[model samples]
Target chain A: MRRDRIATDSGRDVTVVSRNGAASARDAAAFSTRWSYARKRQLFLGALAAPALVYVLAVAVGPMVQGFLYSFDNYNLIRPGSRHFVGLDNYIALWRDPTARSAVINTFLFTFGAVTIEFVLGLGVALLMWRDDWFNRIALGLLLVPATVTPLVVGLVFKALLNPEYGMIGYALAESGLSGPRGLLAEPQRALATLVAIDAWEWTPLMALILLAGLKSLPIDILEAAAVDGATAPQRFRLVILPLLMPAAFLALILRMMDAFRVFDIIFVSTSGGPADATNTLMIYGVKQGLEFFNIGAASAVSTVIVVCILIMAAAFIAVLKPARNRHA
Target chain B: MPDRARLSLLARRFAICVVLVIALAPVVWLFSIAYKPTSDIFASPPTLLFSPTWDNFSSVFRYFNLGRLLESSLIIAIGSTALSLLIGVPAGYALARSTSPRAIWLAYFFLIIRTVPPIATLIPFYLLMRDIGLLGTWWAVIILNTALNSAFVVWMMFAFFRAAPASIEEAAMTDGCTDFGAFIQVALPTVVPGLIASAIFCVMFSWNDFLYAMFLTKADTKTISVALLSAYGTKDISWGTLGALAHFSTLPIVVMMIALNRYFVQGLTQGVH
Candidate 1:
């Protein structure tokens, strides 16, 4: 009778109905069998997810909350006994702090400079390698080398190459009449620009790869239609391809911008934010405060600021890009 | 016009060649320096032609105990990858199956964790590990890396599992398999490629980590990256040895990239998509 009811409800052939009805009924029965069974499935799925949730809570979220609280306290690792609540003094000090202000400015400059150049160059390369050919494939493979090398190691390699006297790059640049004696990294005026170049080199391939994927998956019919309308390659690319590529481009921008804002490993090994703080981005400033100065409260405040800045950037990107995403859907 | 188009194509190819050379030159120079004899490393204009020496490799191993550092790095990376997979795969599967608003929020929570700078977490993590007396241990780095990598793992595998059809697991359940059994037996096999890709990524992230390893570990548990930084700091600059050590540290990941090129590209592109 239940099978008949299912067959009638589903409105299928009788033979097919019997098989599916049994299967569907079995599934329903499985869920219906003791509340314990339904609850068991829920428990099992929840249990499966529990470990990651617990781990994230313990490690990521817990540290963030603790860091926020620490920002309000005058806690120094070295002088643990002197720890006391300061309540926004650290944040207030940030307004007057020259070094902190410089770090924030430098971070913005680096993020914008690096990500912008990376996107432009990455798009160029992606377009160059748009065709699927042996040469392009090989080029793409070789490109991954820089992107895969550890950032710390990349910093060391560049530092060695830029070592003023005997360094390959510094020697070449000096011989070419490019800047003064201390080399690019040491020159206060040029240090940040050089760092931006290094960052662009390291990450542009990632941008290219992401964009290439976007280009590959672009609607061929649309491009061909544009071409059929007597559009030149450049016109077609500008009119059709660029708009289609915006979502990927924006995604690449967001990822690279967040990373650029948090840039540390390279700067740490190469400049250590010097040539007299010329390269002291926010991460470097925060690390210097917490680790070198042992001023936990100030470092936490810097961290809070960095987090807030990242959130603002992310929100802005989402706000701008979400509509494009929705329209496509 | 056809001639002009062909000329443009040639120009594009030439430009790409220049870009590739620029991209690969520094790495090639590092390798060249690593293989050169010590005296040749300081030679004016840097000699490209020389009898390569294993002395740098031997010296690094002798002076730095490269084996122990490699061991520490491997232990931490593998431990983190394993733990991440253990915790993250199930969560990914759950996220894939779930349609609840809570699940959507949970996904955002994972994304936010990944997006936040690691340094922001480092202060509290450093203090927390110090207070718990876990600082400078393999366990400390391992746990921290697990925390970092698991978020990524969950994010990557969440997409993977979502893309996979749910019908197989449903069929398995109809065949009298328990919910857990269906997941283990049916769903897991289907996403093996994704599992491998995510594992490779987790290992790379952990192995390449510098900030956490720098802050968390001391002498006994120091990873290769920290060791490389210290080698740079020693009084007499051994360019050859530094290059050799850098090469040694990067070799595993380089090999992985080459071997798993397809999967790596897929994983990266898929994440963005």
Candidate 2:
């Protein structure tokens, strides 16, 4: 008997019997057993996956497509029946508007500053907690508490703590004349930076958690080998660990960058995009247009811009970090 | 231990303590505010210690309808999580067991779905809900959340189910078990931790979400996070009330974090790999 093998994409072999007879008879035999089995399997898989695919397409993709169309029209909810399409005018308006321009700039600055600091501080924290023990475990749990707090609440906590007249730290700093008379948040020049610091504080713990998880996953034998070769701790980290840890670092950085770019909850509650528009990010601007002002078209335009920015940034990150990943592999 | 080694250990412990303090201080202060007398809350030079009170908690109850808010949050979170898991886990298994090369790209498509800016979809989703007569209801929020979260669940569980061995299921097949039976009995049991991790993530994301909740929910269906928004209004600036509400909002997830610490770490690292 001769056996025929069907190869799967994953390289698994599914064997079937090959028969000698009239071509039609042989084809019928194959269809009844092997071909039907493969067909059944594919149909089963497709059936399993179809629900989620359909749900996302309907609930998520449908609205996204509608929103993209809305971006081209002047569809202010407040003005309901007077809607009209204006080709690329909303995008042109975003360019001309100084606040929108500031928002775009602020968003970039916030993402870069917060994500960089979080990555560095997170790596440091991860290193400190590397020597698994009872104390470190407890510390790890405690440290993640900040991350678990709602971002809006995080803003509220900071706002209360940084209130100039009565806030503990804010009062002391203001009384001692270290900070500005009003408060850190009240000063235009310092407000965005303070929010960035606040963003770092709320999120650094999460960054640390992801990086620590990554650190724990690093093969100990490789590190030990590096040590046995007489490399110092810093040298080993630079040469051996960093290269191996690129994927985790890439993950952590991308996660932070995505969230930081959109940086809404804290900014919404804390600054409301303001002290002279210092912290007006794309999210804040978009929400203000869509929700507060009911300018759906303008809001959709702003939303589209943000989505495009995120896509470009994600592509850039993949382009830059994927090469490192390929090299590691 | 040698002197140098002992010193290094001490330094490490001390550094960790510092990290802990910086990490927990804002949170501790927020919690402390709920217990402090209203008078002491804003005292210039800030009283180091004062009599504690439950007035903030009482006020939170009076104003916020604490029970109703918590119920809404629980419904939205649990509803979205259950639905996501139902649709997402099966799809993840399908992708993982797939023989097609295009399956990996489909997994990446789900990843990209997660990064879709909320503003992009949320506005139209809001209009959609309004048109369908579901706006200001928990279902409105639940449906939108399921869309985003199921995508995430699909991606994460794909990574997990991919990492899991298919050989066990194949053996079960050889032993006369059906494919579906093997999946339920053998494959599902293997990825229990992943399933739990994905559920935890879904719950956290849904529970902590403010944007969708704020947009979709009305006075009757407000979640705890949305309630916190009212507490922190520009005019009133009720620190005590905000703090008290914050306790309820943060505690459940915080407890979940500590309880499922192992899976949290595992899910994150595993998903990446």
Candidate 3:
């Protein structure tokens, strides 16, 4: 009824539904507007969403579906798929292989370690800078420089700076009480940890920035009230800030963890999965096996695992964000 | 004391200065190495007062075709940025204006695609490149990069386009301009900041990217970042020369960022709003 009324009123033309038997024309007019408004909003949302749909289909859905199809059979360079189904052999071997196992472990360790450290350090830095001064502004600009640099370039810089002989960091650390030649990349136990540190160094600023933004946008009244009530700094952070900041913190975690787990640029730049596979992340291993070694099946298996992980994380983030969005709304 | 807040402010100022110094220290170390004598680099207690020299910088150009390497990096970075802008800007405008449910969904999908880790597809990407025989070509670099970065560009530009009033474009359309012409003439200028931000981000990511550059290229096509990685293995890395290469390679990016710090700041804050 509302749709028809809106259509008639707008001169766009429509089929009118008259409630002549019981309802008055005034009520009918209101009813028409109610339905038409809903339709217009629907139309608005639909139009607002169209290009994004096309882009996703073209870039994302197309690629993954293509990648998935390629995974099932041996899509070799020369053979280009003889078009035979190999079943779950790829999945099976991925579970069995020692290199695969190591890759899995490294990926997990990298993700967990890098995200944790980056978050903590990021949070710490964010709090320290939260006082809001000229210094904060300057620090904000200067600090993001590292985060802004390409990860590959960072790896390159670290490669030089961590060199055993003349690498500035190696030289300094050795003189100042550290062991081995370029232990960050060279030492087995420390390589992953070092990568975590490097990841932290690079991405923590991003976390800080995001958290800082969240901090600013937060209601100042809460903090002021807490302070007026004689709440300690820790208490204030615990009760008020933490609750409010949860969404951003979680968002940052999801982001950093996603990137860290699949970290390739820095590892590639620095170690190349060195010291007998200490730094061989899943993504790196997949690339090595698939692209470098031309083992398409293995690579696909690895990619599938990674995609699953991403989907899981993304789902969790969405789940987390919904409540936050509601609260804001 | 209630006045302690003032004291805290002073302390915070001091702390910031300290952090800034610490951050600058490592980068400064790079600059110092590029100037220092090789013997002085590992000199006992490492002399901080060594006189600066141009030898390292000179050796970089002489020893490696550093100029060509820079060109390669620039080609890859600039080409990717340009390509991303071309596709992303239009997609953003269309998504912004057209009340198409399908398009909005695609843009969100693009956002997810943009955010997904590129490392996951390294192998497939390699194979794809090899088969196309574009593995070592600039086209390969640009295509992969544009693909990887365009999603980000679209997301950024979409939001920027949203900030622009649809009425402005429509008004232009009603007057004399075509739809495309209105977007091009009016909407494009309005979204300059967003475009600048996206371009900078693309350049930085592409310039600093190592994995694709490493996997995709051979000697003839190596980017600066890749070239730096290979520096050590190239007939034994002479500290002076390698340091020089690193120094020069780092300069262009630094200069670009420092010059456009406002864009960098704007880019970070834009999405959150």
Candidate 4:
């Protein structure tokens, strides 16, 4: 019976294709068309895609080119009338600038710290909520709150909480003799760590959700087989699950790392890259150069460095994880 | 063995509860502060219990012109979302249906564009907007945001469209429907859920943006995020009013997430799968 149905389906397909061929040839002859049907279809697809491609080129690609140019020239927003080329001056200046050096170092420190902590915490929570149940569902719903809140709001909320004078956490810590009077954000030594903590607080939920999805989709047969073979839970996870989970883990890491490298809003509102520039990452430094100092060239240069750093990091991540991914596959 | 397994399960449940509480504490604290009276705001070891007051809310509205900022935010968010969808949905459909290698490359191009940090484009956008005299206007913010969001929309909708079956559209075309007509009539309705999900994400990102809004907008067109930041920068930081403003800016997004919780989760997990 299945073979008979398949024969009829093929007969229908052949008739349909012949009908389409006749219709297309007639239509082409009537219109004196130069393009084939497939070519026309390709043109239609290209036309459909043109608008977005044009917009991205104008807004993203064009600016990227202009930003590259701006980095090498003495382009200042305030002194727009007196623009001149100064090849590599801004880059050279950045190398000599202590603040730029500190910004680069601080950016790495913050990204590394935040991504590592968020991954570990996110994995832990994901493991805890691996089972699908009413309680776990509610917990996951609650987890979505932090990730959904605006970063700016998170920054403001933490700023209020960590206020050295009468803020709740600050007061509690001071009273308990755990911190000094300056509090976390105000202390030069602790402000960067505080920024990392705040970032982790807001984004660890996102990491958890992604990792949870990974855990949920993991092959259960292998896990069960290992269990039946008398393997311990830790041994099973370490030997089998961890290798399979690498792709998801790497994805979460790359995303969080890229975002962490561009850390701006939270640091902008909470510390303003201060308690004496302790938390001045590349983003804040770039904005300060452009808007605050009106050093557009230097700002563009800083942005160039940031883009290069991100690309290198992403390339490194893909290189290291590709082999693992291939092995799993 | 069963007893040990049950004990481990209980510990896992406890840990989940702790994680949830930690995740929610800051938001809860902000809400607490927003409703507290000015006197209660600075009480040593901030007061958790107080007579709820509308004073902060009133002050935020009365002094900050938060209503206008809210309107600006709404306009920019909705405008960007609409523009992104208009430009992205068709592009996404085309890319999904095209068997050309160039189409695949174009899809990857959009993904790469999505990864370029907004700061990289800030200076040029600033300069170009100034040159065009679009500085400090809603159109400038809307256009730039639309540009940013279009990449994301295309990326996401490409996935959605790829997952949708091609046979249905092909059947429509074979039944005398033009390609565009087939896409509009047959392909689009199937991806309504994906469209809605992508729209929500676009709105969320555009509304929550701070850096671009901060640089691009002037006093008249300030978004709530930038307004809140400026309010914080004042020497005499009014904690109560700031909290109220924070709540005002965040409540809509939180509510939307809750309302569309399942879709939002599905969107986040879609790429992973």
Best prediction by TM-score = 2
How good is the docking of model 3, as DockQ? 0.33
Instruction: Give a tens-digit lDDT track for model 1, residues A23-121.
Output: 766555543563454456667878888999999889988898899999999999789999999999999998799988999999999999999999999
> What DockQ do the predictions score, one after another?
0.52, 0.61, 0.33, 0.56
Better of 1 and 2 by TM-score: 2
* Comparison by DockQ, 3 against 4, better one: 4
CAPRI-wise, candidate 3 is acceptable
Question: What DockQ would you assign to candidate 4?
Answer: 0.56
Q: Pick out the ten consecutive residues of candidate 3 chain B with the lowest summed lDDT.
A: B98-107
Residue lDDT tens for model 2, A199-266: 88988888888888878879999999999999998999999989878778887798678778887999
Best by lDDT: 2
Residue-by-residue lDDT tens digits, candidate 3, B7-76? 9877877776776675566566655677887777767544667877887777777768877888899999
For candidate 4, give the docking quality class from DockQ. Answer: medium
Winner by lDDT between candidate 4 and candidate 1: 1
Q: In candidate 2, how many Å is residue A268 off?
A: 0.3
- The TM-score values for the models, in the order shown, are 0.91, 0.93, 0.85, 0.91
Question: Model 1 over residues B1-273: C-alpha lDDT tens digits?
Answer: 699988988998899999999998998887777788888777767556889899988888778987899999999999999999999999988877764537645765676677788878898998899999999999988988888789888878887887788888878888899888999989999888889889989989999998999999999899998898888988664988988887778877877887887788888886666
lDDT at B273, model 4:
41
Off by over 4 Å in 3: A1-63, A74-84, A159-184, A326-329, B1-3, B97-104, B119-122, B163-182
